[model samples]
Target: MRKRPAEPPVRREPEAPEGCLTVAIRIPVRIVVLVLVVPVRMLWDALVVAGRFLNDALLRPLGRALLWLGRAVFVWPFVALWRWVVVPVGKALGWLGHVLVVVPLVWLYRYVLTPVGHAIAWVARGAGAALGWIAGGVGAALGWVYAALLTPVGYAVMWVLKGLGAVLAALGIGVWTALAWLVKYLVVVPAVWLYTWVLAPVGRAIGWCAKGLVWLVSMAVTGIGTALYWIARILLVLPALAVWRWILTPVGRVLAVIGRELWDALGHAWRVAGHISLAVGRFLGTLFRWIFVEPVRWVYRSVLTPVGHVVRDAVWRPAAEAARSVGRATRQALAAARESVRQARADFRRMLFGEPRRPQPVDRREPSGRETRTLGSSTTALTKD
Candidate 1:
């Protein structure tokens, strides 16, 4: 046998320490809560009882009647229309659509469109094959022309162009050197002088002015922001923090305690009231039973029961038998009269119109009663011989 593992120790919760303030608040709060809650709880109980009585005696039956009336007025008519009118009309429309539209469309697709499509597909295949052969022949001819005639002409043109290019290169180099010398003296030298002496000084002055203006603007904005921060802190934040810390926190705690006590008192009062109401109801029920119910029950058992039995045996049974016999006689007489009337009608019809024709059987696919299949001679196709 193995040793059992050690059991875990149970942890106990620490109790809350109550102060003078909590103690002072609790007693008066509880007393006040109980006083306020008792009457409210009683009134609530009374309302619940009244509501239950009203629901049972009036509201439930009225709701059932209204429900029946609503079904009769609204739901039943719609149901009848759907069943008798709408369903039949919808079915007839569906059948007509199937016969008039769907059947013809299906027949056209199957018999007319399918054969036309096959013919078009066959003609397209033949045309595509002919076009492919023509394209191949044209491509081969173009390739042969490029290789045999155009190649030699292209080579001769390349040689002539190369000779002209060499002559142009020599003339271009001399003209390019002359233009470079003129551009350096007339345009490049003047542009460097204007930038170095005039534009550099003016740009440095404008940059210094812009930096000073930016520094002044930044300093003004920083000062204004700092002043606003301090003003808001003193005017709004400090007072709001003080109110929250000193006033609202304490008041909320007091209110929370009072609310908790009141809720507990209400629950307690409700339970107590329930017991009081149950006891009172039982007492009243017992009083009523003794005063009225017992006397009525005794009278019903002692006087009414015997009298009812006497009336049933002496008067009710004999009258009931007599009424049944009379009803049977009356029914027999009516049935005989009905038979006579039916016979008279039959005779009158025979005198006026002669005998009605009896239908004669016609030949059909299946065998008749006299020609049914037998074991000796089979009607099945495989065994006909």
Candidate 2:
């Protein structure tokens, strides 16, 4: 590339006056501030004024009205209720509860519960004492029983056991000595002599004789047993089999046939009797229905029920009403009499015990208006009842 021509010397512009530049910058800033901040401040002021106006004109009055309404409708009424009704009722209830429940409970605990607890404790102590005494007596009785009976029995038993032990020991020693002597003298010597001299020959002869005799006897017995077996088989077994097969079998079959016939006859008779009984029962049921049930139903429908309705509607109802009226009148009269008696009694009591005071003229005028009104109302209530 060709060497770039030397760049022209850059010409810098002369700097503006600092005051003018500052003034120009401040003018724009002030214009921008005036454009933005002035309107914003005015809007803020207007909003504050509007807010104040709304607070004063709308919100304040609304709040005051709502507060007044709340006070009037809810708060004042609630306060009044709490002060006038709730407090007094609460106090009255508290007093009544104290009188009815707390006082009674305290009295019960003091007079009844405490005394009952003490009595129970005393009874428990008595029972414990009695049980202890019983235990002591039982122990004493056991000790006495042991001393009176068991100790002597134990000693006697011990002595008897000792005597028995001594006797048994003596018997054991005698038996041992006798056994030793007998073994030495009788058993060994006899066994040796018999083996040497007598046993061999005698055993041979006895064996030979016994063998012959056993053979003869076996032969004889075998013949006798075989003969007797055949005889018994022929005489008893064959006859028994024949009798069972022919005579007893026929007889049993005849008896079975007769029994079956008798059973069938009895069953037939039973079935006939059952049928007859069912027929008789049906006849009786029909007769009862005709005689008793129909007549009773007819009577009840035609006579008894109508009569009962008449009595209930005409006689009983009127009687009951009359009786009620009479009872009410009687009750009212009795109440009036009781009131008069009470009044008289009160008057007498007053005369007898009332405080000494200046005598006042008795107005003999017919009862006062209030008294007449009360009497009239009472009489009206009683008459309505």
Prediction RMSDs, each to the true structure: 9.1, 48.7
- Computed on alpha carbons, the lDDT of every model, listed in order, comes to 0.89, 0.82
Cα deviation at 181, candidate 1, in Å, is 12
lDDT per residue as tens, model 2, 336-369: 9999999999899899999557998785534555
Model 1 regions lying over 4 Å from their true place: 1-28, 155-255, 284-299, 322-385
Q: What TM-score should be assigned to candidate 2? A: 0.39
Clashing residue pairs found in predicted model 1 = none
Lowest lDDT 10-residue stretch of candidate 1: 363-372
Residue 122 displacement (Å), model 2? 40
* Local accuracy of candidate 1 as per-residue lDDT tens digits, 1-385: 9999999998999988876776776677667766666666657767888999999999999999999999999999999999999999999999999999999999999999999999999999999999999999999999999999899899999999999998898889989999999999999999999989999999999999999999999999999999999999999999999999999999998888778766766677667666766776688789999999999999999999999999999999999999999999999999999999999999999999999999997855446767876677766677766
